[model samples]
Target: ETLTIKTASKTYPLYIGKGIRFQIQSFIQALEREFSSVLIITDSIVEPLYLKEIESSLTDFSNVYSYVVPAGEEAKSFSVFYDILTFALEKELDRKALVIALGGGVVGDLAGFVAATYMRGIAFIQMPTTLLAHDSSVGGKVAINHPLGKNMIGAFYQPEAVVYDIEMLSTLPEEQWRSGFAEVIKHALIWDKPFYDWLQAEIHTLADLRDEKLQFALAKGITVKAEVVAEDEKESGIRSYLNFGHTLAHAIEAGLGYGKMSHGDAVAIGMLFAIRVSEEYYGIDLELQKFRKWFRQFHYPEIPKHLDAASLLQLMKKDKKAQSGTIRMVLMKQIGEVETVKVEDELILSILEKELEEVQQ
Candidate 1:
């Protein structure tokens, strides 16, 4: 199946299904643009698995070259970003050059940022090899992490197209599957009450994601994201809804150090925390126990006891959504309805303390 992301910045296609990655040639041809050279930026883990195959598919199109960064969150680092740029320069890649991000979120963000800044800009495609990339790859919100915060350095650049071959997800470990579904859950929670209900009713375990059901969930999640991006391309308004769980999620990732915990796992905890905060602050029932049970079935890790609430609060204050040292969080008024609130640090700290104490138990 295919979904088109129409943002004010650019419009692109998201091709989702089995074996879509192998069909890169046709998609590249459909672009109707010629590239002087092509750089396939991937992670070390994906390099051996899919690089040669993607390179072979693009051989007839241009001088296909490959650069592999260390896999995982660290790949989205300034050093690695600079190295890839150096590689691109040494290879004489120009404005006509095309970049292919051939891995998960880290590679997509790093490569997309490189394309966004490389010589002012260049064309790129996202060939997401992991399930988590389903959300990160489609939206064009690409960036590297900062020591202070996650995705502090980035851009809202769109891709030429995104090829998410479901078959590529076959090799992902169970943890990756757990990680990717967090964003899918976020998409449902922030909008589409029906979709949220569907997930609660039908999806019970990782093993249940198969055939059309997996594709349906993925396409559904992507559709929500596409529509949101279309409405607010630069995140000046409703697009922040997409960050429903991300405020705490990013803080956790940065607090624990990136790569220590998967993005999706962090988000699962963040969503749970948001649900609790919503319940107490907004006086709404978000089925907190139901979500907790479901998360347990998938084995999401808990927030580390060592991550002090004060430190996390400081990190969150540095979030892009923050204003004048105040914390703004996306809170659910109800499932499918959300709003951004400038939560007081005292309230936030109290909730964090309670949540952290509960996590310890």
Candidate 2:
């Protein structure tokens, strides 16, 4: 199915299906009718996987060149982003040039931001590979990480279209599966009760990464994300709920070093902590036992002993959601429901001591 998200500036389509990458030609043909060249922004890992496919698909259209940046979380670097724009400008890419992002979160964010800024905002298409991209790929949000915080600098630049093909995930390693699964967990926790139940009942090991179950999960995740983005394209309202695990998750990733943990893994721990804090501070019961039971099934890394309660709390308060010296987080009162709430620094520290203490244990 094709979902169209209308922002104030443009209407972007999201194509969700198996092997949809083959249809990328239609999107590029549409862009070609509107442009003169195609600039494919991909990372090292994704370039080898899908760049040629996109090249062949767009061969009938304008000329195409790819800028392959370092893959994984590191591609969101500002220096590398500058280099991409420099390369494009050196090529004398015009406003007619279309930027195609083919990869996971980092590639989407990096390439999307470049499209938003280059020539004061050009068009870009999203070809997402990882399961996690089901969420990041559809949303108009684009960004890069700052040394002090994750996603600190970003713009809400809607893509020309989000083309999601479930087949590309087969090329990913097991660790990438674990990373992507983290976001799937977040989707279920934030908006889908049946999905959460299904995930717990059917998905368990890295080996389960390939199957009908994964496709169902990805479709459900994209639906949830698309609905939220359509309602709050600028993140002023319900869209913030998508960050349920992200406030602390971003801090954890930053504190532990960006690449040490995948975005979803950091978020899994963050989701766990958000619930614990909600239970402690707001008396909101999300049935913590059931939640943790499913999350723990993933067998992800434990929060290191070196990451102390005080240190983690300090990092959390620096999160973008923090206001007036107090840390803010998205917490769930129950399955499929979430809200942004404020927590005192002392209370956060207390909750962290308890949660981190358990994670370390």
Candidate 3:
């Protein structure tokens, strides 16, 4: 199946199915009649497993080269970004070339940035292999990491297409599923009440998420994201709602060090905190106990007991949603309803401390 993501700048097809990566060569050939080269940027973990299959599919296309970066959040760094640019230049890639981001969010973000800035931008494709990537691959936002913040350096450069082969997910570890499902939950919470109820009732374990169930959830999540992006592409308005749990999520990732915690896992914790804050300040009624129980069933790691509220707050100040020293968090008025609000530092600190204390208890 295919979904079209309509952004302010352009529209692109997100193709979802089994074994779709094998058809990428024909898709690329059909999309661009004449291209100079095709660069397949992947990661170490994915390279051994699926790179050769993708490379084989592109054998008919000439000047196809592969570049592999380390398989983790660290790959989304200035050094790696520069290295990819250098490699592309050394391989004689130009504006006519196409960049294929062939892994999860890290590869997508890094390679998309390389494509966006390399010689004033070029065409690129998203070949996402992970569940978490279902969100990142479709959105036009691309970036590399800075020391202080996550996704701090980036651009709104959409891809030529997104080829999501769900077959590739068969090899994903359980931890990866845990990581990806958090976004699925986030998507449901922010947009689809029915989906949220369905997930809560039907999905109880990793095994429950396989096959048709997994595909439906991914597509539903992607559809929610696409609709939001269509309405507000550059995050100047309603698009911020898509970041429902990301403000604290990004802080946790940066505070613990990138890759120390999976993005989805951190976001799961952040969602709980957002819900709690909503209950406390916005007078929203969310069943904290039931949500925590559901989260535990999914094996989302507990928020670390050692993380201090003050330190996390310091990191949160660097969040993209922050404005003039105040943090703007996306809080839910109800499931499927959310808004961004400017939260005071002390109240945030108080909530953080109370939440951590509860988790400890």
Taking all chains together, each candidate's TM-score versus the true structure is: 0.94, 0.92, 0.95
Question: Order the candidates by lDDT, highest first — what do you get?
Answer: 3, 1, 2
Error of 3 at 121 (Å): 1.2
Candidate 3: segments with Cα more than 4 A from true spot? none
Rank the candidate models, highest TM-score first: 3, 1, 2
Alpha carbon deviation, residue 110, candidate 1 (Å): 1.3
Candidate 1 on 1-361: residue-level lDDT in tens? 8889899988888999987777899998888988888899998899888888888887466588889999877878888999999999998889999999999998999999999999999999999988888898987898997766568899989999999898888889999999998888899999889998999888989878887888999999999999988999888899999889888888998888777898899999899888888888877688899889977888888887899999999989978889999999999998899999988898789889998899788
135-196, model 3: which lDDT tens digit per residue? Answer: 99987999998986678899999998999999999999989988999999999999999999
| Distance from true location, Cα of 297 in model 3, Å | 0.7
Worst 10 residues of 2 by lDDT: 27-36
Candidate 2 lDDT by residue in tens digits, 27-94: 66654467778898888888887888878887566578889998767678789889999999998999
lDDT of 2: 0.81
Q: What TM-score number comes out for model 3?
A: 0.95
Native-referenced Cα lDDT, model 1:
0.89
Q: Pick the candidate with the highest lDDT.
A: 3
RMSDs, each prediction? Answer: 1.8, 2.1, 1.7
